[model samples]
Target: MRLVTYRATVEAEARLGVLVDGTVVDVARIGARAGVPLPSRMLDFIRLGPVAVTELGHLIEEAKGRWPVDGALPLPSVILLAPIPRPEKNVFGIGLNYIDHVAESSRALDTSPELPKQPVIFSKPPTTVIAPGDPIVHRADITQQLDWEVELGAIIGTRAQRVSREEALAYVFGYTTLIDMSARDCRRAGQWIYSKGQDSYCPMGPCIVTADEIPDPQTLDLWLTVNGVEKQRNNTSHMLFKVDELIADISQGITLDPGDIIATGTPEGVGAGRDPQEFLSPGDVIEAEVVGIGKLRHPIVAG
Candidate 1:
């Protein structure tokens, strides 16, 4: 089931719902009536584990009876927000997973960085997250080389530590689309924290697709386009470290709790790797898509 979080009205707070047949079934309301106690927020659902998700699925099915009703629950599109807005922890990201991205970035740096003797990990602060259709803040003064990266974000379902690659995928809740907006200059300063941690830099989600929906994570096609021009186009099959390996590697020493997001890295065609370089400016539109998951589209605005 595809789950979403949205605001039904300007005055109403954002609430979790299930996306079905182009309508959102409010899970909280349905759960209350059905005598199932489920959290109204997506993060809470993640924290509740697979049992809660199963209950939510049942609630969604029951809630389907109420949709298209006149003046009852408001139409879903009236005020939609980010599905998993404000995650508890920084969005974990891996660099140079795609062979093309590795090659291009290496060439741009005039040095071939070793293909991660280990998973080169970094964090994008939670504040940087925005939802699909939200505005991406382009800090023109601080960064003249703003770039876009289309990445596959994996959402953790269960808490795990020191998991093996064979069992890594079992801990996943589902998948979503993420745009890892970057400031190239800030990144080149040596530390990636500040460069990656700008408000509205991480735009993710339309909805989270349960792991069962996607049979093969590695075979999916992922792409990104800027202002109607295809800038990044590649399949997940090119990833140097696959999803299972990434999860196992990341969880080796640190515990991966529920709702923790790990972006599996991006493919090629980033602006920073271009000839003479291309960068994002106000009014630029970015759309990132992954098969089986969904698309994330946002416009660039002055910070």
Candidate 2:
């Protein structure tokens, strides 16, 4: 099931939806009309766990390919927000999880070429998130090296700590496409919070495909493009530390609660990794995708 958080208008409250036949079936409306209970927000819905997912699935199946189910709206008639537009906590991130990306960073950014012995973890503040079609702010005053990294974002459905790699996938609620917008030159003393955590730096979602629909997260193909030209492309198979390993490692002690997102590191082809280097400027456009999940397109706008 492809679940989303959307709004009929800019001023309307965001509501949970199920995307089917190119139309958004309002989950809460369907539940209310069907005499069932369902939450209107993505985060609250996620906290309900499998039971909520099961109920929503039944609602969709019962629709029988119906268009405009009561309260439903055409996809283009609504605004699609990030699956979790305002997360409860900072987004967890992994850096250089792709071997090829590690090599490219070494060439273009003069970073180490050797692969990390463990997952390189980082965080992006909640303010960094924006919905699909939003502008990715280019903070020229702060730094000129604005860049893009397309990543796979995993949304956690349940609390997990000290989870084994084998059981890590069980904790995932679903997946979405996340663009890791970065200010390449903002790195200071080896920290990335400022470089990658600025407002509008994390453009996520078209929708989240439920975990049951994608049993193997590592088999998806992901890529990023700028102004219609491809800059990055790689299968999740090339990930040095796969999703399960990341979940297990990151959850070793820190608790991963419902609605928390982990952005699995991007593969090579970022602007900073290009020959002679490249960067985004106002008016430029970026489209990042994790096939099977969805794609996110954001225009580069001045900060």
Best by TM-score: 2
Q: Pick the candidate with the highest lDDT.
A: 2
Q: CA shift at 51, candidate 1, in angstroms?
A: 1.5
How does each model score on lDDT?
A: 0.83, 0.91
Which TM-score value belongs to model 1? Answer: 0.94
lDDT of 2 at 223: 85
Q: Which consecutive 10 residues in model 1 have the weakest lDDT in total?
A: 67-76
Candidate 2 residues 1-303, lDDT tens each? 999999999899999999988989888888887788888999999999999999888877886466345578989999999989899999998999999999999998767889999999999999999999988888789989999999999999999999999999999999999998888899989999999899998999999999999999889999888899999999998999999999999889799999999999999888888888899999999998899889888899887
Per-candidate TM-scores read 0.94, 0.97
| Clash totals in order | 0, 0
